[model samples]
Target: VWSREEEVRHGTYRPQSSAQLKATLGKDGKISAWRTDYVQSGDAEGETSFIYAIPATSRRHFSYQSNQRDGPWRSVNSTQIGFYNESFIDELAQAAGEDPYQFRRKHLAADSRHLKVLDTVAKRAGWGTPLPEGVGRGIAIVESFGTIVAEVIEATVREDGSPQVLKAWAVVDCGTTVNPLNAEAQIAGGMVMGLSSAIGEAITIDKGAVVQSNFNDYNILKLAGAPAVIDVHFIESGAKMGGIGEPGVPPASPALANALFAATGKRIRTLPLMTQAKA
Candidate 1:
């Protein structure tokens, strides 16, 4: 990940690119048998650690090389990571000659809770249904801050190299949801922001200041570009309570990316779709 730059004094330097990451995913599409290498690119701020949520019979490993800066921030960055990781997973599924939704469902069998959301979202999005050429449906699932969110997006790729999202469906399991209205709004807001970033939000550094200062330069999802329909469903699984704020964001970006790949047969490794693959 590349960090932003800021200056405290003229002709002086302050660096933020303090951490670098490399990861490898193994076959079978599970988090098992994978490795991640992280290096600290600057002065040491604190110690680094690795956390894994492996059930029995799992084999996932990670390594961290730290000089130090600060721990990675959540919210925004988590969405980016989800976009990168889940998109790659979809590619793997396609390479294996399997439907992306079914591929993920097969791998997530261990966690019935996760499967619940995945199955529900896919059903709501009409998974396995036929679509016109150049149109595709994509599904992605993420657990953020203990809340599990699964999203499915329907999108079409136009000849002009632009992608238009048609509809979005989400199934969130945050345990017993206290307030249904608030949870739905939270999830919908995350989906909008996530789609906006995936479609047209790019940031670059020049000298030491941000090149795009305002919305005019940093384009966002306009009314016409936003999804025509969005459905958010909550599952009262009676599990442990979880946060609803950020969980919805991660799946939004990845689901959109996967849908684009399905439509165009091209993978997008970078944000702001136009950067790598056109349309």
Candidate 2:
């Protein structure tokens, strides 16, 4: 789950969602087939939330609508789906006794842009390298609005059992990056927001009235809690134009979740991870 947004957007905020993704592996531990069944319900009428996953066939996207319009925040639905699906992927890898990084590699197509981005991040972040005690690294890949992005985060367990994010690495294959500097800023900002909400951010309700009225009782990822370093790398797949702003937000939280499980051996099943401290 995630921090639920207020019902103020022209575009629906991402609804609380549930999904089950099942994959079958061959004898060599390669994914021979996979399928995802997604569900979204219990929302109000006229709610038109949507999520775009990996297309199974060649396709052309003719229209281009950015997700930054006044009331239509980008990637709300994608972020929810990424968190659930990617976290499930990590859990599957763990259950199968396979390295998460290597497991994803075996499933991706050799020539796809998604694979390239995933490979880029893993190699640059030294995916297979050893880490000091109590250190854990996690990776996640997500595709939305014509972009394929991969992220790797390294975290450590604090003395009190809380997780401390030290660094993050992101690789983007967004078909084309119009402006390198702007793209970098977009991804970095998205990651910061993603981590911010994942750590601690929520809007409670009591008797149909809002509970968190201001920042005083609410949560935010202050500077003191942010990752010290975030590195962004881009790959121009040259297939078609894609939105840079929306794609970056989906990967950060899931990568952090996987990282936490690795650092503490506890699977995360809720949001505002502080609520499940040391998880």
Q: State each model's C-alpha RMSD to the native.
A: 6.3, 7.0
lDDT accuracy of residue 29 in candidate 1: 49
Model 1 Cα shift for residue 133 (angstroms):
1.9
What's the true lDDT of residue 57 in model 2?
Answer: 19
List TM-score per model, in order: 0.77, 0.80
Clashes of each: 4, 0
Instruction: Name the regions of candidate 2 deviating beyond 4 angstroms.
Output: 1-14, 21-26, 32-35, 41-73, 159-161, 275-279
Tens-place lDDT digits, model 1, residues 1-279 = 322222211222212221222333456544443333222233222221112232323222233443223344335345644654577668767766788877676666556888888889988888988998878788888776778888999988766777788999999999989999999999998898788877887655577455765566767888888889999999999999988877788788779888877877777766677544464
Off by over 4 Å in 1: 1-32, 38-76
Task: Write down the worst ten-residue block by lDDT for model 1.
Answer: 7-16
Q: Cα miss at 257, model 2 (Å)?
A: 0.7
lDDT of 1: 0.69
- Cα lDDT for residue 223, candidate 2: 85
